[model samples]
Target: MSLLSEVERDEERRAGARGDGDVDQPANAQELAAMSKLISGSGLLDVREGELEVQQRNPNSPLHSVKAFEQLNLSPKLIRGIYQMGFMRPSRIQEKALPALVADPPINMIAQSQSGTGKTAAFLLTMLSRVDPNENYCQCLCLAPTFELAKQIGEVCKRMAAYMPEVKIGYATREEKYTRDSYSNHHILIATPGTAQDWVMRYRIINMAKLRVFVLDEADVLIDQQAFRDISVRLSRHLSPGCQILLFSATFEEPVVEFARTVVPEAATIRLKRQELTLDNLLQVFARPASIDIKYQYVTLTFGLFGLAQCMVFCQSRREAEVLQKRLQSDGHDSLVLHGQMEISDRASIIRRYRNSEVRILITTNVLARGIDIAQVNVVINWELPVMRDRSPDFETYLHRIGRAGRFGKKGIGLSFVVDDTDERNLRQIEKHFCTQIHEMNMDDPVQLNELQKKVRK
Candidate 1:
């Protein structure tokens, strides 16, 4: 029930047998990274004297899973805030993570859980509880990979701290004007890596030494990208020695896991089993077009039939996304485009509209594969199936792409487009790995399309 492709699962089993799981190295790339780390002493981590330390979780020991938020001995005010935010009990990750995160000693945590599982809230509570709102100078700091995600974290933190008027959350994203040449009173700082790095190392506005809790949201992406990985390492060097470090992501390839250990070592760890991340809530299907251009036919037909439902159509390139959006718009569809090339402000504006349901279709690249949360998104179309940089089927990205639609236990439709045998092969591998069936869609069949409409309406 894992989300990995068949080939990656085989690699995982072999790597696990050897106890080395990290991401992207050699062309088979999987094996190269792990093998190199065990040998070369390269990358951010200076090879320790002993081989990389492995902290195995105790199978039976409970770190304290609570039936309710009150069981955690949280301040009554905090419990009220949780309930105010509509959280009644602890989610899987929250239950195991809250007690460890808010403990007196403040344990470091490395958590790998499915998306939409309340990881953001769990950490925000720990951060808010740790910060002294009365004497604020950016006591708690969280870094996400994108401005959209950083904003998302800020929104959740604000809601959870709504009752605690003294707790303030500030952003360090692009164009954020923080006090210069002066120390500020903001208690919580949410930002992306580059801006956060500049704020800490370059501008000297917020002192890293004063931070009590440091969080890296979507840590796998931070660790996977070289520029982000470098900034993360530099940021880690600036964190107060006592700062509680928390890293959370849905997918952690092996090398990224190794780097996570290097950055936040000897930490409490919580991970959902592989089966938990499968596409149980998404109705998976694929449509093969006679040619690449025919993908537009599928797109128009889908929107033409299900015009009211919000959907996200993922493309492999910015150009394709732009082209699709233009085509859809010309055809009288209210669609928007979100890709990496757009200006930050434009990107933020588009997401705001999409979240507010001002638009029905969002065509984009992998940028929206993970972070943004819009409950209205009930359909996901893989206009271009996700693939790794090396063009192999991207098991993790595929999981995240479809995950955008079937959010948090809601049923949704995930349709993938295959223009050639290569895509068909990749889709089959995805099916084999996740142990699920993706029925071939027959667009010409009126009855089948009607059934799809009914499923979506459900």
Candidate 2:
């Protein structure tokens, strides 16, 4: 049976046990209405199948376009670049977002879609399209949270803007090669918030007056941190008055959404439903170890059984990640540890090695969670549950962590470890927050573990 069907059956049994014929209400009114319609005996699987249909039928949405890229009236050079990039047609997000983004009388946009859903290309296209090719100065600025992400975005921008040779691109990360004198000539700039702010204020490297489109690649994560948020707000203040602002992320909580609304006034928004936020193809399961020591043993055994080409093990802290990496190495597993504390060049090199399949296992904190897209990852192990400073479950972090595996319609597995009551409680909270079920697994049973791995590998 499908996973959603299993969840629905479990929910029905619980509702019957409670002696309440009504289904459990969701946390908010919007969710309540959506769930009421979803569980009305039509089946959860049907709702999942029809999610895109429902979204398209929403008359108020700006993302319902059915036109082709050529039909969008883009320049021939830009169209050729897109075709050369191997995109025959626009993805759902591209179809919906491109129309509004490239429209005249420029409008601000706040788009939230799942990872690997063409958000990067969507904004990059906008940035490239907005740049005046004749202008030899910076006209578009894209800010990401990390130098790695900024460099990655810069690479994609370079590829997409290949045919449009006049559109110069610059990287404003710490390792940027441009000197203060030559940095101002690029038409597009991809940077981290801190570096972008310094370039604007201290070095006078970026020409804020000529900036046309300002894009925040990972808006949710960028806005959540106080330091990045302050620097971003300050950077925005220096942009041209008519600069079009665009914010994009895979997930946006209520506070972040509110913040986006405040910063980008009257922006066009494209949001996915909570249920739709989690990729349906991902197989999410958790293992309950009897003790903390057993958790490491279980991971070692499971890694051997799966024989995965590449996997990412997420830890709650850098110290824990380092410790786990050492233990895995001692167990003869080839692994690398990465966190925010490492130098940017080191982090970038490690990511490149991991992406090239030179490293089979990567143990990291949340640094690689949000926007880094590596498609070869077959499994994701949550060595520790994601939580905030107050120790509450961070649902968005969990989503992004697991998202690193099942990318671009690929099947993958997310295995979370529950060591004790606190960890189990946090996992349960995450399951409830996503309105999905995370099946429990018996790590001690080799036969069952093999069967589960087979299913995920298929």
Candidate with top TM-score is: 2
Candidate 1 residue 116 Cα shift, in angstroms, is 0.8
Lowest lDDT sum, 10 consecutive residues, model 1, at 40-49
The digit string of per-residue lDDT tens for model 1 on 74-107 reads 7778888888887877765675678788887778
Lowest lDDT block of 10, candidate 2: 41-50
Model 1 has an lDDT value of: 0.73
Distance from true location, Cα of 329 in model 2, Å = 14
lDDT of 2: 0.74
RMSD of each: 13.1, 13.4
Backbone clashes under 3 angstroms, per model: 6, 1
User: Which pairs, if any, clash in model 2?
Assistant: 63-96
